[model samples]
Target: MGAKMLAEAMGMKALLYANWERLELAEVPEPQPKTGEVLIRVGHVGICGSELECVVQRHPRRKPPLIMGHEFAGTVVALGEGVANLSVGQKVAVNPFVVCHTCRWCRLGKSNICERRQLMSMHRPGAFAEFVAVPAENCHPLPDHADTRLGAMVEPVANAVHAVRLTGQVLPKRVVVFGAGPIGLVCAQVAKAMGAGFVVVVEIAPERLAVARQFADAVINPAETDFLTEVQALTDGEGFDLALDAVGRSQTRRMAVDAVHPTGVAVWVGLHDDETSLSGMGIVYGEKRVQGSYAYTDDDFAMALQLVVGGRVEVASWVQEFPLDEGVEVFWQLARGEARHIVKALLRP
Candidate 1:
């Protein structure tokens, strides 16, 4: 059925990106599922850091008059034609990246980099609303006993899994994570779950650092201490086997490369900044490998869900929840950095 046909039947509240640097709780016609799609009734949706950056900076790709949410958990309220695998009332965590299966990257099992990829918030209406339509294949079913909020966390955890998996390290002895944001914290936990001997987290925010201490073997505040010296001391001057930078600044990027031992790997996952200058000779002489990680593949997503469901990673304690009606205030508070205590925020619709 067409959306226009359903316009009079349903009206739902959504946090709309009505304009640049503005969010409004507006009632709009709920979306209708198309062929091969499923209409979900949103349960919990996370406010991604990237969404805050896009809204505050007015990113070109994420144009306004859009509903911007991707990390979400919901129930299958209705199924479109040709979608027979899912049924009404089934709980699920969604993979928001819609890719063209015929692309070369997709064929190589790297659909995260597909040439023609469409993201939920950027390319179409997202789960910030009461209802969203997504491809049936994008939904990963959750266990009957699982908390719906945990389903909302699967996306960010998948990001950490993808970043750590990209390093190709088997049971790294020591790992260092820059930034104690949601991604970095999860990376530390994932490294430990994958058998890293020790994990260190570096963050300037004291609130975030305090939370980091819960998961990391050691937490460092660069503003109050010598970061490189402390890192070297922790590794007995040998440096870490792997370093992951969840902060995309030039300094953190360089530090990630420097914090790893010779021939070690450095993975960059954050997107705070675009351009950075590094010492070419240093990377060459050290033989250090640097890789960039984007979103997760299907396998990574499934693995992440397993890790979360199996209780290998922590989620509930660090996440804060608010009503969907308060999304505007919550978004602005997060954008202004007022809610340091909240590692993650979810809007309950």
Candidate 2:
């Protein structure tokens, strides 16, 4: 069916992952954006780390048979009549998290962690399908020179935005990022661009560690040695100034705590499956501050776009494009860890 016809069409198939068990394509009704919303013709949609957990029935947010995809970029094929500023035919990226604009946190310019949020892929139909209907306010115009594929990355890069800004230009400082996944590697590059003295990445996956070396000052595989001991020795026994736990497990989180200097800061960006414990004694004696980060805010997305525009964080090599039909196979392969060579994969429609 034509793009326009599909937008107006009453029925279509939305990919569903029933709480991490299995993903099945289902023929269902098409969705129309309400007033103040816009309908996009999805072109390039990417699978995320969270999606993997959702596929395996590990993530808490993956509801039964929900249309999944929060990372996407497409053209505004149709607009709900009440919407303004964005027009049909305009290319845009969808920042899927919708926060209440009137909250105190929002007023303080911290809406990404707002109390009330309506996020896509969790509460509503996501962009993995051909079309997505979202609030017009969530749409962002893409750079004229930017590829639709770049859309898949903006969400993750926003995290780098928070990472770079959180430390506030603590120059000549060393930074370590745990987990060589997309967010970790991207944050490493952002730290370098922001003028960190040294940036290191730690991961267990050899393949992902290789990619991390491409962008980080150093890459360490924890399996080969005691990563914490090595990190302290590498920093002359003082440790790094900033440590990030991009890997959500309790092990990585503890590693982050042990890898920082006495007064250094550690940021927790990973979502974990178990209750995590902090070394209270370490916090008191070490004076280490641990902060938690979540999805991007609008300001974070804006900063990420500028970084891409300035050629600070290159994402051209991070994307792996596949036909939409291969979505199931590709997802399964990624889950089994066979797709290590592919950093991020997009389902091209």
lDDT of each: 0.92, 0.81
| Residue lDDT tens for model 2, 258-292 | 89888888888888646788889998898888877
**Candidate 2 runs further than 4 Å off:** 1-10, 18-20, 58-60, 169-172
lDDT score of model 1?
0.92
After superposing candidate 1 on the true structure, give the runs of residues whose Cα lies further than 4 Å from its correct spot.
1-8
Angstrom error at residue 134, model 1: 0.7
Reference-based lDDT, residue 314, model 2: 82
Q: Name the best candidate (by lDDT).
A: 1
| TM-score, cand. 1 vs. native | 0.97
User: What TM-score would every model get versus the actual structure?
Assistant: 0.97, 0.92
